[model samples]
Target: MCACPAQKLCTCSASSLKKTSNHRKQKRLFRKAFFFLQRLTRGNQTDTFRGLLLKSTCSFMKNSIFSLILLFSAALTGFAQDTIVLNNGDVLSGEILEQTASHVYFKSAAFGSISINPRDIAEIRFTQDQLGEITVPKDAIAKNEAKPPNLPASKKPEKAAAKPPQKDTSKKTKKKKQWSGQAGLAIALRNKTTSNLSGVYKDEKYETYRLYGNLNWKGERNSLRWDWTYRYSEDEYKIRDDFFNITQKYNRSFKNKNLYATAKTLYQRDYNRRIENEYLQTAELGIKWFGKDSRVKLSTSAGGGYHIYDRLDSSRSNKTSVSLPKFIFDENFSWKILSAQELEIIQKYTHLGNLDDYHLVFSFGVQNKLVRELFLRVEYKIDKDTEVFYDDKGYYDKALLTSLVYKF
Candidate 1:
């Protein structure tokens, strides 16, 4: 009678409610299983599920053990066993590729490769299994050994053998001084036979002779040079031209070696030009634009000095003596075409207080070495002076000479 009242209040049975709860539980379990399978097979759709899983497992295991593998390798190989201790209390670890007298080459993982001066290194330590064995000093071994019984006074250790004195091999070598000289002579003779106006045969003889000498002494920083030339000519048994010149020069070089100070003196006499005698003294400063070591050398100088001109007829005529201040400019050029051949050019200008009264001289030459310290030279020279006497004759004089030179 009590169940009749409860059934009238409830519409579903207990068994149906239990079945519906079971269905919901099954659906939740299926969903969880599907999601778990999807997660395992993601990102590996082209491969079989078993292969993908195997690969992933292997990758994880390899990553987890990589550092352990590296550690074992380093321990076995001694990666940084080549150690260098520096004098400044620093230590460097690297693989030493080579050691030289002055430097060490090392390779480091961090720095790639580098050079180290031996002076900066205090010690080098190598692994026990390296190519070479480290040497231990006797003193170090003695310190590590046990003490021995004291020796008698007569058995004391002998003094170490004394080392022989070493030679001083660092001094600079000195260069030798150079000396050169040249001498030349030339002669010309002409004979003319003709009939005179009186129907008489006459003979005319002309003669010319020239002599030249030059000496040069070159040292490390100084040079001395001298040159002399003499010429005598007779035309038809009458003296036509007679002249001589002597010149001396001393040069002192400065610290630069390319710059120098020079003192020069000259004495000259000319009968054809009416210059009985002439004297000149000058101090000059010069620069060598191209040095002696080069294939070509050029030099220039400028100076001022006093000049004296004495004429042969000044004493007999009303002409006064010529004394004037003089200015001079000089240029010298030399070129070595080969080890045994050379070319030279020299030019000089002397101004006697006026532009119109000046003298110019130019010389050019070629020299070929024939033997050791001996050479052959051929030269051409021109001399022009505004103050010289010039009439129907030319205003300038020209000369060509071939000479042999010797050097010491």
Candidate 2:
């Protein structure tokens, strides 16, 4: 507990100061009178001064001495009071008059009564039990204003430390899809005829239905793809053609370049042109002319491999099985004609054993997006084989397909 009032003290007015000054003067006068009275009565001669005067003077002197002792005690008590330490390294010896959430009211001999922000106070110490009680705890001082231990209260406080920046967790990177696949079913009209300038033989026209699908999986450095095709043809009376083909390819791309390496395997079966079974394997190096999603894309590749085929013939010379070295060339291109439309072309040329014996296939297609993950496609294909196995001269085949495709 402390004696300084919680409220501002108005006792420092001019009148109050005048009263204190009068008290000091009175103390001095009393000291002189007490000495004077002592000397006068030193011999214990009461009779000389008269009993009434001597008694009154002795009584007055006793009261004055007691008042002087009280004043001296008050002065000494004021010197011994409470202490307060500030955050700015300032030390204060004073009485804590009042404490509030926002301010600390203090009374100091040097600064007098003043209000201080609680944030600026570092510590409070009470030297006497009689000092006033504080409802607010010493820890109520704001944490932001706390000082370092190495610095003394008399030195200036150091600048505040800078705060570290926060991380941005709201945004994240998304991964790209690694696998893509498509399946399609189509109906086609096809024509195959060996006769050209002269109508020495008849031409064959048939309606065909085909189903095809492809699966592709790609990674940072390599990729794999598989393609499948199946077709069946019928005339007015019977099934004229049945065909199926499947191919698988693996590719590895060079680092920081558009070049790539590829290996492929193929299996095919067709009964119309007397082809019962065929197998092929190839290795090639290729380059991309544009990015995967570019508006226009073109690529070409050349490779060599061996071809094996089994043919059916009732004639005198029946080639049931044969394997021959082959040379191959492939071209692929695509163009996006509109926001939802695209055109594609693909051609492959294969030379089997002899120079005159070769196979060629060319296809052109247009795809229109019909809806999400769905497309309508139309394609025309031309196929020719220079080697003839049956009565038919070099085989020539043509087909037009309309298909519905779904992708995921």
User: What TM-scores do the predictions have?
Assistant: 0.51, 0.56
User: Which candidate number has the best lDDT?
Assistant: 2
Each prediction's whole-model lDDT (CA) = 0.68, 0.74
Query: Can you tell me which runs of candidate 2 are displaced by over 4 Å?
Result: 1-174, 194-200, 236-240, 314-318, 340-355, 389-392
Query: Where does candidate 1 have its weakest 10-residue lDDT segment?
Result: 136-145
lDDT of 1 by residue, 1-408 (tens): 556857855645776788999999999999999999998878676577779899999999998799789888787546646887776788888676665455456666676667665556667777544444433323222122333333321222333368999988887878575987777665534343322234234454555578888899988788999999998876443545678999999999999989999989999987655676689898889999986688888888888878887764322344447888888877887777775444443333343335777877777878777777676776766666667543322245666656666655
Q: Give the TM-score of candidate 1.
A: 0.51
Task: Please give the lDDT score at residue 383 for candidate 1.
Answer: 66
Once model 2 is optimally superposed onto the true structure by TM-score, how far is the C-alpha of residue 14 displaced, in angstroms? 60
Tens-digit lDDT track of model 2 for 303-369: 8888898876533146679788788777777777775444343333443344678887888888888
